[model samples]
Target: MVQKVVIIGAGPAGLLLAHYLLRRCNYNIDIYERRRDPRLTDISSDRTFPISLQKRGRKAIQAIAGLEEAIAAQSVFCEGTILYGKKGKLRQIPRQNPVLTIDRNRLVSILLKHLNETSSPNQVKVHFNCECTAVDGTAKTVTLHPKEGDSFTADYDLLVGADGARSQVREYLAHNAGFTCSQNYVPDAYKSVFLSRLNPSAGVELEPNKIHVYNLNNQARMLMVPQPGDQLHGVIIFGAENNPLEGLSTKEEVHTFCQEKFPIFGQLMSLEEAEALLKRPVARVLTVRCDRFHEGDSMLLIGDAAHAVSPSIGQGCNSSLEDVLILGQLLEQYGDDWDQVLPKFSEQRVPDAHALRELSDYTFPRQKFLVVEFFLRTMVKRLFHRWFPDWVKPFVFDLVLDTDLPYSQVLSLSQGWINKVKRSST
Candidate 1:
């Protein structure tokens, strides 16, 4: 029997899930996204940022044949990070493994392209500019609002909510089912920033294979990564209450502000970018935590919808992709029987998701003193762990980035540091 699988939100998780299910050859997949097709849109018009994929996320992409290579072609492989301090002072932290960084929209385009080229129209269909407004578990149907037409309902043998943090399916489960959920806005907000990697006349060029970072104080910071076209893309992150760009009324003021505060990037920024920066809206991250990810045998949530965390540690997408990977594994184990897969997935993943929230929230300290300790600990741990192999585990950041250790284990090993940071925040 062919199951009709309806996936909401054609982001990484949904599209990737389609790829996995299509391999089963017994499921017809339909993905509905609230936004327009990224492949057909102007990349610059989209308010998106770069995503850094390390081991966990990359392993998931590797499972789908040729997908990793497609993504790698459009990505920049970064070996280390350069941190800029006041007066051009800097620090470099090199990584043992290079990180693959790609713009979020570009990643989506590649995934969508692969889906379209490999799957027949009858096997898979993607509907953009359509939003999932409601779900009826008993009726096995979902209500969708299309951009150009009246709202309609469609039936599904299985429904997966990869709709992101503000998911209507998750909302329905919380209200109609017994799912427990909590949501809070992180204290930080950010604006997408774009700049050329090189400024020839100024003789300023950031390393093409490195991630660039600058801190204008604890309240404001910028993290940029190189893209394929000599482009540097990142975000200017600030405390919600302390947006440095708030008082700048004109593009010239914006330019002056960047020049004074972040001179290296300021030299690379164009007047047009400054004007666009002035007009760009501030974006706040909303973190979601749910007790479990599945409501019943046929309804499930993954990715940001299930466990959205702060991108502070750069595991948001990594973990989301890993969720799809794990689901694929469970389906294999349970012979594609969702009745057995959904509950087991929740039972296995909920703890890791909760632990990941802790790691993501408190891994990076806010206090200046702790920040120093953080770098010191990270450096010492890496060195000592290399020498003493079994004696010292790498610090939280290293363990998270450099290994595929389950997030729960990583949290357990670094509980002391997590506790210290948590206390300092209070």
Candidate 2:
């Protein structure tokens, strides 16, 4: 008998899981998404930022064979990051390995296209603009409100919620089932930003192989990554309660502000981009910390729906993709028995998720003094570790970005500094 699987949200986690499951011919999967079909819409309409995938996230996509190559064709690999300051001072931070970066929507489009090319409608179905509104665990059914039709209920032998931080399936498990969950808005919010890679008259251009950042202050910053066609795409992140772009009514005003605060990017910014910036919605990030990821044998949550963390460290998407990888492993280990796989996944992933929150929140120091020390420590650690590899570990940020070491181990090694960061903020 074929097991029917229903996955909510066609985001990275959901779509990737579909690929993983479809490889095993016994499962039929259906994915529901609230947004319009990404391939049919303009990329900018999606309001997505660039996602940097390291080994942890890459390994997941590589398992499917050819998926990683497809994504790499559309991605930009950066070997380092450049920090821009208000006074035009620049600091370059280099990474040992190049990280693959791609706009989130572009990544999704590639995934969806590959998913279609590989899987048939009989095996897997992706429904867009269909929102899941409720889950009935005992009935083994989910109710979805589609854009063109009346609400409907579909039954599933197994239900997986990869819907993300604001997940409806997770809500059902917590409020109706016995799952305990909590959600909080992170201190920062962001608006999508775009810039050209060149300015002919000014003769200014950003490095094509680097992630560029401009810190407006302690309250706001812009982080942009180079795209394939002489474009820069990223976000203007700011304190959620304090919007730096407040009171700016015109496109020229927004343009002037960027030119003054981030002169280089400002020179590259176009009037059209400035207009988009003025009208784009500000999106706040919500972090989800759940006591458990699964409720009984029939239902489970993965990715942001399981453990959404702050993008402060760029691990939200990485960890989300990693969740699919972890679950795929457990499925193989348990011989496709979800009853055994669910509990083991919770036992293995819950601690790592909790530890990830700690790592994400404190990996970068918040204070001016500690921020300075952060650079010093990272440089000294890199040099020291080269001389005596066994005695010293790389910096926490390095471990999180550059390696696939478990988050639990990384937290254990960096807890002292993490504690200090939390304390200073308090």
lDDT winner: 1
> What do the candidate models score in CA lDDT, each in turn?
0.94, 0.91
Against the true structure, candidate 2 has what lDDT?
0.91
Candidate 1 local lDDT, 1-426, one digit each (tens): 999999999998888899899888999989999999999987768879999999999999999889999999999999999999998898998988899999999999999999888899999999999999889999999999999989999999999999999999999999989999999999999999999999999999899999999998777999999999999999999999999999999999999999999998999999999999999999999999999999678999999999999999999999999999999999999999999999999999999999999999999998989999999999999999999999999999999998999999999999999999999999
Q: What ranges in model 2 sit over 4 Å off?
A: none
lDDT of 1: 0.94
- Compose the digit string of candidate 2's lDDT tens values, residues 1-426: 799999999999999999999887899999999999999998998879999999899999999989999999988999999998867899999988899999999999999999999989999999999999989999999999999989999999999999989999999988988788999999999999978888989999789999999887788888999998988999999998899798899999999998887787889888899999999999989999999998788999999999999998889889989988999999899989999999999999899999999998998988899999888988999989889989999988888988888899989998888998999988
Worst 10 residues of 1 by lDDT: 39-48
Quote the lDDT for 82 in model 2. 97
Please, what is the TM-score per model?
0.98, 0.98
